[model samples]
Target: MRSVNNHCDLYDFSIWGNEDVSSGKGAKDENFPVGSLLISRKLRPHVQAYYNFARVIDDIADSEMLSSEEKVKRLNGMQAVLCDDVPAPDRADVQAARYLRNSLLETGVSFDTATDLLIAFRQDAVKNRYETFAELLEYCRYSANPVGHYLLDLHKENADIRPAADALCTSLQILNHLQDCRADLIRLDRCYIPLDMLRAENVDVQAVKDEGTISGLRNVFDYILDYIDDLNREAEQLIRLTSNRRLRMESSVILTLACSLTEHLRKEDPLATRVKLNYKDAIKAVLYACPHILR
Candidate 1:
């Protein structure tokens, strides 16, 4: 609730704040996989701070070493920090919270977007599998939609863009879930693929662990691809609606990659192998997307 700029310093902290991520992975560079050059340099860090907040909380929620009770306590501590309800445990949490306070005072980033993300993270602490596709999507509204809303707020775009942006963000989340389905289950006991869909295809969770394949789940891959296509198509409206040239191009690049990956998923079994977009395709996506993006 309280603004952090004058009271707290963001520069003095990193996301880890002396705690090891063990993976040695640093903060989530909101600009990295996407590229800093695509957007203004000045704006990158401000938004990346939000990403750092997400990464830190995600670590707390996703860390395999911690007991569920510990993760929940740490996560609730974050909510308290955000609410100015309690003192931050580290300089990074304080700094990240400060950045959000400033964003609300300056660029119109919503408190709900910042806070609701925790709800999803908390859900991760307990919930394992989604019973239906619609259920998974409802989760995406909490987990993914906040991100799109925040981005729009950052760029000062029209509020109407939120729906389309939500679609784009949700598509990315679902795609990543499919790509990492094997790791998620084996590592965290979490499964993002809806159970009903898998059942309809005649597959079960054990089939996933025994082998990467969808455990005799016929049409599973196609079903996922079809959903990806639908979500991507719906998100195209957002790409076209984006007002800023840089943001528009950036969204286009993402959409291009999303489509290409969907095509690849169609050809390969996601349950069996992790599909990566090669460097060539990555560069091509930028080039192809740049045309309309620059317009």
Candidate 2:
């Protein structure tokens, strides 16, 4: 939330404050973070501050060494810091903690929303399987939707926007999970796709884990992609409801990218190959998405 004029500073704070996200390792998507930082600057300072805090705590939960219990402790400590019960902890995430305490002092966020995010990240620490799409949506209800709720609250948007924002956020989260399925399986030992869907498609998890190349993979991928397609269409309606042009543009572009990834994956089996957009392509994506981005 601090004025991070330098790209180096933004990247440093993002990485240092969020050492838990290994997904940044493969091919860095600087544009997304750059856009986020720019949007943070354009919006309220507390918006960016809270997001940074959320990201850092998420990273802590995702850390390989930290047990779920330890992650919960860190989150509880963060709550203590948030409530001003104690001095900030000594760690990379502490700057975020201190910033959050200050932000809370300035503009308060509901305790329920705050706790939901921590609980969601904690869910990531242990929960590895989703039994149904409904269950996965419940996960996003905590992990992704609260962000939109916070942002919407910042803008003083009415209850009408919550439904739209919630739908968009959950759609984006589901698309992200589908796109990262293979990597998530390898890295986190987690699968976001519901077990019910897998069973419906007659897919076997053990074979996919072992061979990583089975007909069942293709069928399951098809099923997942179809489900993502429906969410994407639903999210489009929400983009129109957002009053802020930049936020609309940001959300739209990201959703477009998700849709693009799904199309690409549908064209080629991800198990055989992973799809990545080069910098030039990503730049083009941002460019194409610019005109529609409301302010």
User: Among these predicted structures, which one has the highest lDDT?
Assistant: 1
Model 1, residue pairs in steric clash: 212-271
Q: Report how far residue 42 has shifted in candidate 2, in Å.
A: 4.4
Candidate 1: segments with Cα more than 4 A from true spot: 1-23, 26-35, 91-95
State the C-alpha lDDT per candidate: 0.72, 0.65
Q: Superpose all Cα atoms of candidate 2 onto the true structure and report the RMSD in Å to 1 decimal.
A: 7.5
| True lDDT of residue 36, candidate 1 | 49
RMSD of each: 4.9, 7.5
Model 2 off-target regions past 4 Å?
A: 1-45, 108-112, 208-213, 279-295
Q: Distance from true position, residue 21, model 2, in Å?
A: 9.5
Give the per-residue lDDT of model 1 (tens digit) for 1-295. Answer: 3222332432333322455333334533222253346767867876777776777778777888776776665666566566563445455544566666565556656777777788888899989899988988988988888988887878889998888888888888887787778888899999988888888877776666644564345376577778889989999997789998888887888888888877776677766678767677678778877678547
Residue 96 of candidate 2: its Cα lDDT? 71
Clashing pairs in 2: 245-294
